[model samples]
Target: MPLPLHHLRAGIIGTGFIAPVHIEALKRLGVQVTAISGSTKGTQALAEQWGTPEVYGDYDYQSLINSPNVDVVHITSPNRVHVEQSLAALAAGKHVVCEKPLGMTTEETAKVVAAAAASDRVFAVNYLCRFYPAILQMRAMVQRGELGRIIHVQGHFFQDWLLKDTDYNWRVLSSEGGKLRAVGDIGTHWIDAVSFILGARAKSVFATLETFHKTRYRPTGEVQTFTSQSDPASMVPYEVDTEDFGSVLLKFGQADHGHVSGTHANCAISQVAAGWKCSLYVGIYGTKGSVQWEFQQPNEIQAGYRDQPNQVLTRNTAGFDKDVANFTDNPGGHAEGFPDGHKMHYRAVYEHIASGKSTPVLYATADDGHYEVKLCEAILRSSEKQTWVGV
Candidate 1:
């Protein structure tokens, strides 16, 4: 008999902002979060807060991977260590759900792809934005030719958390977070969601990247993501190498679904956009109609028509229920946004594992993750050369 989803235990490998989100979602799914690993200062506290039994502090993820209590490994660590930890977990016969970008570059992520392919274990990349009910509904419409022949897509993923020069995170440094900061950190979420909805991959890219702050101040000691530094006197200055903003144009290949072929897309990615906390807005236009949705308002999608009346489709309601019934739990009026996206994503992944891999793969796979990294590399190259670059 296949194991129950709740019986398959999870081990988390980071204690940053995203790590707790993973823990909360897993707990909501009734999965046993048995182990937590990260810096010694906060690992135990996080474990205690979540009621996880095993704690591997001082970044000792190898020990956590080898733990008998852990059946699945969730790599939420910094970008630099994702490949190393993922490779280790796969070797130890554990399923993996890694945070996106997969690795710093395509070269390292390719190794992970090979490792995941060689093993029977399930490997997923945390492109959780795909689980949003509105996204799924849009995808179903596109596949069913409800959107008609695809024309183009335009959107922007903007955030203001890192807007100021004193706003510092490890992600601001190229050496720490890889080359593309705004694009890699949050823009990939937008790109992956678009690909998932359109049922296609970006074939080539033309991009322009800029660093608004050539030099920024950082605290002498490390700070967790989204946390503020109190003392300006204790700050030190460093040169910023990663981009603060990017504009990218993409040409996507044909989807097996007859309605979508050779779609054009453009996206503006930025970390310096003031007043927008975390807004990912996407508008898909086609020959028949158009659909628009934003991350800030996740519960509904606006469907536009040329001659007929436009419609506001709400989650769990008519026109939206059929496509995303399995992913959403709340009733029509109740709001489910960011946290719920993570919950639904883990639910899909966990159900697949519990069913002996019989469930359809809605989650992003190792190859999908690797392709996103390749896209990032292409974006960087295109920005440098000021021309189109194939992914």
Candidate 2:
């Protein structure tokens, strides 16, 4: 009575670095990469790289969205474009899987959520880190109260690419991405990862954001950077508008604080630290003791409790909760990384479109994305106002 998965078609709107990964993951699931849309010739070429046949050089986003050939639209557009593009897909009545910070502002994020609710179309955000088998185990422990009541939560993400003066991209521009800088791009992960795991929301944040480099230079003016090698001279001069280093003191209240307090809590993110290649670390202090995990060592979850030796929970290990255990395709010790998370998320979204259903399974819904943006906004407010701000 249902159509087979291979019959479904997915259209990808951006051919940026992240888009290809989504395309490949879809291909692995046997979903047709029906259409590729991009404004740049460079991106169009990228579409062909993946063996996708259809290329709309000056792609009409709305046209591709409403086309009968496409069943789902994946939005991998840059920071400024995420909200508009996702809204377009929702307007067309197609399902959507948008990247994080679904909107530049939390208010805009609410619009996306409203759109999702009105359409009855499936919607998911690309916060797939939670889908990892290891983190899922830690979440289950918190959910079952196995770790006792959560006392405190901490998360951090670091990157050094922005620290290079010669290497410049649109990410550094305030007009392109909002002003939160390192925290907006990388710190949001810290917020999302902890919130997802503890199944708690951040209420308020006491934060400070800084831009260490007041200005940067490009030897060659008006050039886009690609290639692992960036021309030292190309950086003309750009004033930094966002914070390169940021830290936040967050308080995500317990269940008894009333949903309002727990749902709105403290969280933070930062950039400009060294040796972090998208590393996400999370520490949750619970009544009995604590639980810890990090994204770099993705497959392993470290946990500790009162008077007990710390335990290492691997994917598919005995202590894993049944809900988390269901996601492990490979047995213990066979690692799953970035692509695997994307693959799992794609598979879940595909199932949603085919079955015509919504899931509370915490695959980062539009609601989650909107909430993240709001959290980011609150972080900015707290940092700017020099006071703790409520989410």
The CA lDDT at 302 in model 2 is 83
Best by TM-score: 1
Please name the candidate that would achieve the greatest lDDT relative to the true structure.
1
Residue lDDT tens for model 2, 1-391: 3235798888888766788889888897889988888776845787668877667667567777877898889887777888889988988878898877687887678888999989988888998787777677777677777777666666677666766665566777878777666777777777777777776777778888888878866544333423232564534677778788877887775553222134322334545566675777888777776777778888887888679798887776677646664456777778888888888777777776776564345688999888888888888888889898888
lDDT of 1 by residue, 1-391 (tens): 3235788899999998899999999998889999999998789999889888999999999999999999999999989999999999999999999998799999999999999999999999999999999999999999999989999999999998888888999999888899999999999999999999999999999999999999889998788887766555689989999999999999999999887787999999999999999999999999999999999999999999999999999999888999888899999999999999999999989999988899989999999999999999999999999999999
Q: Go through the candidates in order and give each one's C-alpha lDDT.
A: 0.94, 0.74
Position 148, candidate 1: lDDT: 96
Error of 1 at 167 (Å): 0.2
What lDDT does candidate 2 reach at residue 124?
88
For residue 129, model 1's alpha carbon misses the true position, in angstroms, by 0.6
> For model 2, what is the alpha-carbon lDDT of residue 213?
78
Model 2 misplacement above 4 A? 1-4, 218-231, 254-268
* Steric overlap count per candidate: 0, 18
